[model samples]
Target: MDTSKATGNNAPRNLTKGEATRRRILDAARKVFSENPYHAASVRMVGKAGGFDHPIIHYYFPKKAGLFECVMEEHVVEFRTFMEHWFDGLDAYTTDKGLAVFIERIIAFHIANKDLFRTLMQNTAHVENFDQFPASAQYEVFHDSFLKTFRKKVHHNASDEEVSKFVYSFTVLAANYLGASSTYARFLGMEGECDAYWDWVKETIHYLFLPRMEKIIFDSESK
Candidate 1:
């Protein structure tokens, strides 16, 4: 399946020569951290991956911790944009438009940038446990935004306590479904195929969320 255009999916661009080099270094660091454990990733390795002579990461970033922090910052911005789009798109999800767009966006992201997605979502534990985690602040911001938006969405259906329950349940279900793709691929039957998976995600969102949301809002308004 189209391996082309795959290599640079995680890379960030748009910079002057100096800024370009710095961006490349950050991309390299993200690549390395996603493949191996973040604790095991090295600045020298990241620098070399970006076609540098030596530990030039030190030149661009003072310490490995700082470099990792930059990587985390980049991811935080990405999450912000993604969440913004997700929220905006909700307005577009209508009786006519359907949930296909929303499902496709999430599934496409999961497949295209699996490593980046995994690193950001999976490394929550690492950030939580580290005493002096460099990326903690960045994650906290995104986490807050996610919860705020999530709470708003759920409160449209349930009480405060119920909204909290739905938030936790919804997030857990989304995470489990997205994260288990590798396993799901093997035995998901027909829906495991990428195209079919998109269909499946659409159906899940429609069946699990939209019916209840419509009942609570649209159905109420109509009544």
Candidate 2:
């Protein structure tokens, strides 16, 4: 309701009762979207999930699209903060060790937030007009800086194209693995062993992928 407090810098501050209600609606929207496809998720569902009246949700977000956008914005803010914290000590470890640690943290984060990641991957994979979403701009800004930071850690001989491909491939692999962990676990006869599956993933990446990557990077540099 208060446009003055809606600015990026001022938002999410100590909220009045009304703003708190808005927050609840957004939180509910997130869960609803995560659990359902975009076409199936509805304002009424979000209202029921949040335990608020439909009118309250409409007052904050006039349409389902608006509510989805707000939910995405909130997720983007939270994810950016998490990534910044995760990359805090990037320079401290050896390159291979640092990358292995980074990958482990990423897997851990995905496992912890599997539903959210599933929603994101599904939306991006299915929505043809994904660029029109409000979160696209935020993602572009975050992605540019993310690649820049990754480039700095990579071997200087690695081309931008190579780095881009690496990032894209790694993201897809991690997201898909965590998002479909349950299905994969069942298929592999390890149903309900989510903890063990995650450990195996981390170890596989650390002992196998990390060594291969180190060799590739150094090999390229030597060439």
Candidate 3:
């Protein structure tokens, strides 16, 4: 069988109409999954959101899992591109600036795709074994590069396991913040504008988390 043409990112490019319908379903699925747990989300709901019949969803994605997998695959592609661009210039920044940039980019991406991030986080929390997923394999390459940069710039003594834990924690923290922006705004008695909240988050990460990590690195080195 003939394959689709490759896009700039090397993924198989879909034809115009096929791509449009696929994106519609994917967008609807993302909203559904973000709002409802994986088990609770239904193809009918996705169809309704996309203004299509359930049969269309079934045509594009034989099962809900297949649709979810496509969502993850798309996210992996975008994320890998983002990481590649960020990592390429990471060495140019000082430790403080590097951390700031990292936090900023992470938060920005999460906010831009808040629903998708929420869905991914929910899947991660419920799924027992992510290793079986092909998307996870692709992500591991970026993860390794991130760890290499982390070790080179900040914590030379930190093992891969330790760095992985830190990366996981940082990502979860950022994702949760973006996922619960309205709730946090209410708690803080602040305006609900995302730009303002993002500014506050960046400052908090820079001043609070960044300093604490830097201090820990300093203390460890002094030992």
Candidate 4:
């Protein structure tokens, strides 16, 4: 019998040397790709950042596109796990509180994964054939998972289109705001005051978007 299909071995295991090396290369690639557009980034740049020879990087990811795809898929998986846990927590909350929790946790996530977010945004804009990329499927999974969680926890009565609009609007607002953190901080005269900048982000969301979101969620519930 094939025991490989069993869940008994699902316990955490340490990375092998090769796995560790690959992780290092992916990390370096993520940082490099985050800083530069895909066209401007190179495997050599990733090698320098990761302290590996370019050939080693090639061995792990023969094509730069493949490396980018791995990086995106890794980030998407991380985000999906986060969303699942986050939605689990929201199950016990009222919609108003759920919205607040959603905003707060999402901001924290954006701040934590800012680099991945930047890479995704930059490459998405520059990659003319993004729809054809293998990573695009991972993005679709992430999107579907997100919408599923949102519907399950926040608005069960909402249509996918309605939920998508809410999700899209919130993501656009949050991503652009957090992605340009420095510029937003400087423009607001809160430069060097990171706490103040984040606080302002929360305030801005509450004042600008939260009420409309609450209305929508409640409207969906009432319907």
Which candidate should be chosen as best, given lDDT against the real structure? 4
**Local accuracy of candidate 4 as per-residue lDDT tens digits, 75-152:** 776777666656545646666666666667766776667775676666566667868765777767766777677777
At residue 166, give the lDDT of candidate 1: 46
TM-score of each: 0.70, 0.78, 0.73, 0.82
Off by more than 4 A, model 2: 1-14, 111-115, 132-134, 138-145, 152-155, 216-223
Residue 3 lDDT in candidate 3: 13
Which regions of candidate 4 fall more than 4 Å away from where they truly are?
1-13, 91-95, 220-223
| Candidate 3 per-residue lDDT over residues 104-202, each given as its tens digit | 767766655567566655555665576765246534544565565556655445556656677666666765666667777777778874677877877
Error of 1 at 95 (Å): 7.9
Over 4 Å off, model 3: 1-16, 124-155, 215-223
Error of 2 at 51 (Å): 1.3
Q: Could you give candidate 1's per-residue lDDT for residues 7-46 as a string of tens digits?
A: 2344445668988888788778888766555676777788
Model 3 lDDT, full chain set: 0.65
* Highest TM-score scorer: 4
What does candidate 2's lDDT look like per residue over 70-172, in tens digits?
7767666655656665555656767666666776677756655555566676566666676776466655654665666666645546666876776666666
* TM-score-superior candidate, 1 or 4: 4
lDDT score for residue 196 of model 2: 79
Error of 3 at 1 (Å): 47
TM-score of candidate 3 to 2 decimals: 0.73
